[model samples]
Target: MKLKKGINIIDQHDKFGFYCNGKFGGNFVAETARKPIEDLSKLFEKLRRSKKFLKKRDFYFKHYLGGETPFFKLNNLTKYLGGAQIWCKDVSAINGDAHKAYHATVNALICKESGKKFIAGDTGAGMFGKNLALAAKEMKLSAKIFMGTKDISRQAPNVKFMREAGAEVVPVDSGSKTLVDAVSECMRHYVSNCDTTHLAVGSAIGANIFLKICAWSTSQISRELKRQLIKEFGEIPKLKLINVIGGGSSALGFWNEFIDYDKKHVELIGVEAKYAAPLATNAKVAILHGAAQYCLTDKEGQIAETHSLSAGLDYPGSSPLHGLLKDTKRARYTLASDKEALNAFKLVSKLENLRPSLEPAHAWSECIRIAPKLKKSDVIVVNNCGKGYKDKKIYIENIGYYPE
Candidate 1:
């Protein structure tokens, strides 16, 4: 099927790519970067005018970003925490059970339109793989997912979800046996199968074009946060937006809307696992997973091994934008230990009846630690990126059983 004009699926150029330290990294075809609607403002306008586009948009809205996720002040949990008005953006409430659902749906739509019959990619905790697999099923495309053996074990539920969604999950047993290795393997697969397959990267740390696409697609979170805050507070409140940085997609999405605003009024905090705190400790610029960025490495410059209770946070590198943010001080980078994250997980479940996946639990850990030091009137928004159902087994084995 010939695609519409202005949409080039196979072209690769730096037209919409990102630069780091004045060097070009990678690029993506413009067609896949912007899907469904060409212009942001014309989304509703287009939906109103075109029944075909509206049907497609409604498919995504109903199956992916239904906009029903809760965005409200966690009054009970906030009072229990004792300082700051804590608000939670419940991304887990999305269709595929995580924020990755948005990007997965967008990429799948692109693949379907590009006339690709096969889709391939890698995942950290399997959420992206699961979501992508579901999208492939809906679009009648074959999916191949590469996941670290370690992640396969820790995120078994998500692996099962992927398989059930008709995806083939391949385990990578290479260096560190984690997300980075899976990324390498997926890229190799994409290189060999480029004609019939498309690699839908799950993170913001990949090729420059993909980073832009994922960040742009997920930026809806920031847009909604702005609107919700205004409605709840009668104006936008001074907020310290906190998100756990795996490949930095959530942070990039959460901060995209606020980028042009005054930096002092809104603070962005990116929390990484203490076991893999490269952004906070040694954010030296390096290349990994096709993009140049700050990565965790050894003296010999080999990618270093990292450990985290959350498989999603076990990556050894971060997105280039995150590195730039660290250098520019636009966002503060911090670390949360496994103990702290687990404690926050238990606290949120007990106090608010919400079970956050270990990934965003890192952000919750940081918020709990810092909320007391801030003014009572200050607002703190935590990007609760994923639900905790997938972590039940790991949580039971590592942290022991929790009472109902």
Candidate 2:
């Protein structure tokens, strides 16, 4: 395939420099040391052409039925912070109130192409599962979403939405009753019925399918970000920071385009839950529970359990691409505690009048604190991953009742 106009070009051996406009420099590491350009291009082409991979979905317009998501301007904060300008990718405008819609829209297309009668997957926060189920139904397929017994309790509202979408919510009562167990069970189901079933993963950290799904889903961020810059300022926005990597898809979406771009000017920082960070503090490169990439592991090489208030970011491992990104210093990974995330969510809601998803809220607050120091004239875009409606219970349980 020919390289697109806006896409960046780089050596297969390089870790970063994969984007169209060189937004992120030397971001993700490339594992293929052999650097056979023809072979690698063929492989990527196979992924691009494979029906099982993905095609575009409808969320581009459906997310904003009325109009494009407004590009939030933070010149006030920019001036206060000295030079940094701030913008937000309003993924909350989507139907499910999260960026999961982007992945779901394409996963449904993949399910249909694979001729799968049933869609099977797992969820912790419920955003991805619900989004996948809705996408499947929209594509005329059946969905079976496996949820942990714990997630069933924590993400009840999302459970209801999945059921309403004609998905069978199977509750796993196994160990932890969290995302890991549910994923193990889902893998079992997939292996048992690989003949007819396809797993629709929400995030890109674990499975190869997830990496592809996320790559396709998150590409929209680049499109929108470019449009926002072109519309607002006469020149392209000088990007200082891009945060959207919780669960890695949204981060991948916007950051992928910048992989080969100018590294000195722009920076890509992925914000994960403070307790569950593969990029921040983890040392080892190992396979995670259901992921095909390198992860943070224990002494026995078992995937280390992650701790986080946001269910979405609680993964023991990150996407292999992310590992590559981290190794190359094309991106910086950071963590935010539950308290910090909750406070960010509250601030965005009060100031922007938008209730962002918990995962992005964590990053948003962190950005708000550091934006003043990063660069005054530079633009920072944070992917507000999802809305906070599904997190109401967790909020009530941890923080307090919503301030009415």
Q: Which model scores highest in lDDT? A: 1
Q: Per-residue CA lDDT of candidate 2, range 1-404, in tens?
A: 12323543222223332322232222232232123222333444565566545223443344422224556775544555464677777767767667667777666666665556788877878888898778777777889898888888888899999999998999999866777777778767766666577666667654343455566666666667767777888766567555645557777777666665566655788887876776787556665533334455778876667777777777676666666677667788887888988887766665666677677877787777787676556678777767888887777777676543
lDDT of each: 0.79, 0.66
**Whole-model alpha-carbon lDDT for candidate 1:** 0.79
Q: Candidate 1's residue-wise lDDT over 106-167, tens digit each?
A: 77876776677999989989999999999899889999999999899889999999999899
Task: Find the candidate with the highest TM-score and give its number.
Answer: 1
Model 1, runs deviating above 4 Å: 1-16, 23-59
How much is 286 displaced in model 1, in angstroms?
0.8
